[model samples]
Target: MSHGVKKRKLDKNAQESLYFDSYSDVTIHEEMIADRVRTSTYRAAILRNAEAIRGRVVLDVGAGTGVLSVFCAQAGAGRVYAVEACSIAEQAVKIVKQNQMEDRIEVIRGTVETIDLPESVDVIVSEWMGYALLHESMLGSVLFARDKWLKPGGLILPCRAELYVAPVSDPVVEERLNFWCTVRDQYGVDMSCMSDFAKRCILSGDIAVTPVTVEDVLSHPARIAELDLRSVTAEQLRSVRGEFACECFGSSAVNALCVWFTVTFPCEDNKTLVLSTSPFKPETHWKQAVLYLDEPTDVMQDTKVAGEIHMYPSEDSARHICIHVDYTIGEHKKHSKTFSIPDGYSEAQQ
Candidate 1:
């Protein structure tokens, strides 16, 4: 089961920092639960699969407030282990008791990777997705849990996930970028030169979590990558690589590339439930990730924007991410750029 990729280990101080950054407050959990798209999807997925959950042992990774664990218990799970690594686990214990499922649900306050479970479980459930699907680094813990405690044929709540990208026209970003030039004209000063610096500051090589409308999408989205939770390893998540090709709908200025993800829950009778954070779909708390180019590129109908994307954890901080994109538009020369999610913006903003 070795993925053959060396996993980066975080030192004790870095681990503590990450833990505090992620779970220092209740606001983060509130935002997640308030996201109807995310919370409802898991609720429906679990309720729809009641047959699979009934009398089966289940594990909820990073079980914030034990919501998913409670859902499993309501679905008739024989026993539910809610594993949380932060102080929030203590709150989850109270929530489980308040719901009167104390006997069926046990809140374990520890990281799933190192936590001890009495026995293997029949299902693993987790709401571990971050902005752009990989920012928080929680999926790695879920994978570690799967390898250690999942039964041979146990189910994962979100069995499959897909990452997508497309060319987009972001007017807000365009206006912001244009503000630098406008300052020179409005104030009659030679401040236009700062436009380059402004672009750098705005496009700071990080994934911009912003709302993108369907009209903003200038091209058809291309599937950049996918992961099957049932078998994917933590090491395999260290780097994800894929090729994408998107065709412009018509002549338009492509200022940024938009990225989003869709996760699917398997159900009986060959059915599957999908939760999409696509711009065309209802918005989630995740919104969509926008990677701005240094400048806008013009494209005509049928213009092909093709590229390869490589996403991995940043070396300096495992919770942060580094993205390398190499792309070509129509007859244009290939361009490559590297983007990083800075340490401070890693989890706090998400």
Candidate 2:
């Protein structure tokens, strides 16, 4: 038996947050399912290890449309609990029934932190990564589910996750900044002064979720941090800090630090299946997070760029994240900046 929330009306802000947090919109689920890299990776991870799933009980945390639960059912799971916190749970029930998995899968409409399962699960599967991997704060719920319902030595899908960072030259950002200055001549007005203000507005300490090409990379990416989900604690995730150093490929205007993540699933054969959202790999809905510098730095070949990255949950919204970066371009040049992932980007913008 699972405890569920009773029907209740919520205010506007509460409603908005629920929608954003739960991804209640069908279109959002459509986009996520349509992402070949993301969906295929999870499918492969589950189907490849059918032996482990057979006759096992599974729990799908934050199961929006119950897709992962369906995958586990198809993989021969005896029972699957699909937990969701918003209206999407109703749809998930329909999706499970439509797929003729109602007997094997149970859709529970409530937050995982509050929901109760009939028995402990042998496996916990979730796609909780947000923009830059921690923007949405849903990992906390997954961790809670793990502590409460996961069996001893139970498996977690994509057991390992790593964050990477590197320098990049974003011509698109430079052109946008320069456009603010060029408008002075086109409009026959002294608008060049607004360039400084425009730069601040555009780069106002928010993670830019944009696409970057491999050619735009100015240096080899460094692995900043790694999380073993099985042992990682929420307290440790509150302030994930890492140090990285990279050498510039050549003289280039390094305008931003590109950040991305990769997750790996351990197989029964001792092999690992990886799903990377790096610019060097196929793009997912997460694209890549670019933290633009207030002013671009020019670096020469062999120029060493070293930095420390600090990430934490935002004070205003737990679902949002704040990133602080301190870096040096050369022996004498040091700079530090703080950025955040805006609520809109995590919500409607996505």
Winner by lDDT: 2
How many collisions per candidate? 0, 0
Candidate 1, poorest ten consecutive residues by summed lDDT: 341-350
lDDT for predicted candidate 2 compared with the true structure = 0.87
- The sequence of per-residue lDDT tens digits that candidate 1 reaches over residues 217-323 is 99878999999998888888988999999989998888788889999999975799999999999999889988888768899999999999999987766766778
TM-score of 2: 0.93
Q: Give the Cα-based TM-score of candidate 1 against the true structure.
A: 0.93
Off by over 4 Å in 1: 1-13, 184-190, 346-350
Error (Å) of candidate 2 at residue 268 is 1.6
The true-structure Cα RMSD of candidate 2 reads 6.2
